[model samples]
Target: MSKLIDPIASVEDDTKSPVSVPSSPKDSPRTPIVALKHKHEDKPLSRSSSLLDMLHLKDVHIPTPPAVKFAPLNVPRHRRLQTAVVATWAFMIPICLTVFYGSLIFSKWLRPLAVAYAIWFVLFDRAWVHRGGRRQEWIRRSAFWKNFAAYYPITTVKEADLPADGKYVFGYHPHGIISMGAACTFATESTGFSELFPGVVCHLLTLDANFWIPFYRDILMGMGLSSVSKRSCRSILKMGRSICIVIGGASESLYAYPGTNDLTLKKRLGFIKIAIREGASLVPVYGFGENDIYELLPNEKGTMTYRFQKWFQSTFGFTVPLFHGRSVFTYNYGLMPYRRPVTVVVGSPIAVKQIDKPTDEEVQAVHKEYIEALQALWDKYKDKYAKDRKSELKLVD
Candidate 1:
């Protein structure tokens, strides 16, 4: 049986001695990859040479890490105890709440509501701020979500018959709190999005407040994401072929708990108008399991959380999505909710004719078309994605 030996001990040669072998053109030969031997020399081979011989490979030595980079391992004696204390306290709230209400919140409807509370925040609960960090960098490649994929697993399905020829405006609906899956797949190319939709460049839009911050602003930019403003929409649609907006804004996220699909878009018509103005086709995408992943504290339409979010929005130009998910400790449950599989299904395209400044009648006409398109997508995929859905799609003001 071959036991694993520490290579460090055997290769700890302080001084690298010269051992002559097939040489460079100026000496003996060029190199193993591209070489012609001229002569050889006699010298003592080190243990590294023996290892190379066993591996049947030429010696292409690499240096060790610089010594100045590492300091002696020194940690406080109470460090482990401190970590244990912090972890216990962090898990205390969930444990208490689990024993208290986890049993009481069991009804079909009640259970869903509890689930909602777990995934959401009550306006003031977002732990971090989106300071408009780097977006373009995240959008490019090798992003945080790519690394995070190992934990928060997600899959993207883009199947709409998109024209490989023109620009498009994709309107994603029912933005569950933070729309984590959509944000990951659309905003970052890490989700294998580009490979799914060839020839199409997608830009996901977020709130302008996200861009107001320093680090977050760059993060957002690196992801090719921008504000969901008219200026942003118009510029993006005008710029190229693909841009997406989480059609259901903050209000949508608030109502995103499973079994209760309430949308606040009856009065929202800006996206439709932009579609008309830009003449880009409309593609509706719905992410199943988006709401099931997190249970949040209740924030009904008239609740304090809801009101606070509106106030925050009016004051700062953007509202915070009060949300939660699996805690760092628990794997199956917590304030953050469970890790559920989210499947985003892309629907057929709704072709639109571009207009510079459409009149009220023109906008309304396009709006009707948009509704049909949205309805078509819902009707086609409702059963496939929303197997346990409680009700049919509704268009309420």
Candidate 2:
């Protein structure tokens, strides 16, 4: 075997060099020199070192950091499957777009079908806008979604059983970066939503702009997502079907920092008004650990970043947040969300009486009750699920 060397000893040896000693104390310099000459003179200069040398920084010695640790090739099959499923869901939009365009371009037979679909989507396809989009039970019950949910291992906790006879409105809170919890829990049946509340079908509401995408829109509609517009919500409620809405929307996503539960719900009265008008019971669903999966950059109010985000939202009706998560091969950083357990708790329903036209006072009264119900839900489960939470829930505008 080769001889072993101590790193500390090697560093000491490399640093040590011969220094000339003076015979008299008066001839010696005030400060003793550790190394009078450059020690790396004999070694060939690296490209970075040469550039630094040209800048008269020959004496500078920058330490090199250790390389990032990546997942080994011998990872478990289940783990690989989980990563693959999550990656597919994460990049589904671009993948769908590419496939849609590529098929039309490469295959001559698909162009006619593509043109007809485009015309219908632009002119007459109001399923996403009216009647809660066509939901295919087969697609909603696909095994693929189970694998996707298993990646985050998302679970749904039903506090009380909602009767099928009652129409309901679920207000999903603290919109996480991409509302992963909301999507997995409501948009898909991966979390056993159907079994938990039998006969109570839920259509998750999203922005109207999302339906503009070609192939991606079909996937969303198939998953039982509809537009969040006033008309769509009213229409869905009229049909006696329940709907789930992420109350915070894009504004709340900006404040989606880990361990924080700040919600932008102070002035949100539209959902409350609609519920009152349609006699839909309001259910507050909180997804504990929703904001913990991704790390978001600080863009506090009054800052340039925050101002710009607000401006962009005003201009485009949506805002893009600067956030990051772990990658498939590494835990340090990428678009893939960290493997964090997200528990979505569906709370008790708050009853509302139907009104022809709810006044401001009536709306405010219902809004207060809704807020209290949501707060109670948070207080009840924060200790159990949010033990690592940095702060209590706050309803910020």
Candidate 3:
């Protein structure tokens, strides 16, 4: 049996991150090992190495010796702490911004409008940033680090174990409240994505409606985000290096209650079918804390929230992912999740032999294997991140 690895605690659980410069192996005690099976025919691949090799994916390494001289905000701990503060500070934005403009638009009488504006940003603006006018390349990159600093900080634990030449389909599970961590970590070159996982380029997939947002549309394109539409998936898989999809989307968001591992996925198979057609290896990813950040209203099947979301989906083709966190004054920790740690483990890849469109059984079989891969990832890393988890993982229908 392969023993699982708890990424967070396995390494220094409380160690602060090193910023800017990458560390040489000598400065660090633990280094990225290369015991992977590169010999192909002659030798068997080491579990981690061989798995990564098969999918054309690579593990990330956390730089050590803390590059203090080159970076000011380089420490990973600061990144985590500051991220919460920023989310809280963003609450102050409408006050400052509105005060600046309200005086002009409404004069001395409507000064409180600034607060209203900030509330608007929190309640409405954050679902996804698709505003139509701004230049987003900078935001995509900066947003990458901003989020990295805010939530779970990750590094490629090892080198790329896959062939330098190949294509892939990366399936990210447990679509956290926003799948925001996935966005910052994989979709863009920011947060050292390429530095961590080289050889394969990743395209983060999202809703087709997102393309309608003005500025956000430009931003996502630059980050290489594509539509989650089946046609788009086929095109992306054919394009080849790599592409990522949240797999369980809006519907998944409804099951965001804490202490549970219900994945609002089972019937969703367009991405999997696309993968079979493209002949790409399937990679399973599970992010701990994806669901723990906020307390969502109970939206069970017959609840008003659930009914509304379903109606909304039928009418708009998109369902409302209802969740709640904090509001500046009302929430001390705020809707912004507290500083609990979130770790995203990239599981070993499940290789797919070339084949035609998969049959129902074939799809179910692949999905079953995919679920196992995801379960293994959880089993391996759970103790580290979810040591306090109330119950073992479960696959809720």
Top candidate on lDDT is: 2
Best by TM-score: 2
State each model's CA lDDT, in order.
Answer: 0.62, 0.87, 0.62
Q: What ranking of all candidate models by lDDT puts the best one first?
A: 2, 1, 3
Give candidate 3 regions above 4 Å deviation: 1-160, 189-191, 327-334
lDDT of 2: 0.87
Candidate 1, after superposition: displacement of residue 271 in Å?
A: 1.4
Structural similarity to truth (TM-score) of each candidate: 0.61, 0.83, 0.63
Per-residue accuracy of model 1 over 1-397 as CA lDDT, tens digit each = 2233334322424476444454555665455333222123233444354454434333344444222222124644343333343344335445545643654465665666655554453333232222222345434576345544323456777766565677877877777776767777787765687777777777888776555443344445767777677776776666664778887786676676665556666767788788878888878777766777666557777888989988887787556666555444444334444446677777778777888888988877777777777777677777887788877777544
Report the Cα RMSD per candidate: 24.6, 9.1, 24.1
Misplaced by over 4 Å in model 2 are 1-67
When sorted by TM-score, best at the front, the candidate numbers are 2, 3, 1
Model 3 weakest 10-residue run by lDDT? 126-135
lDDT (tens digit, per residue) of candidate 2 on 184-237: 888888899999999998999999888988888988999889999999999999
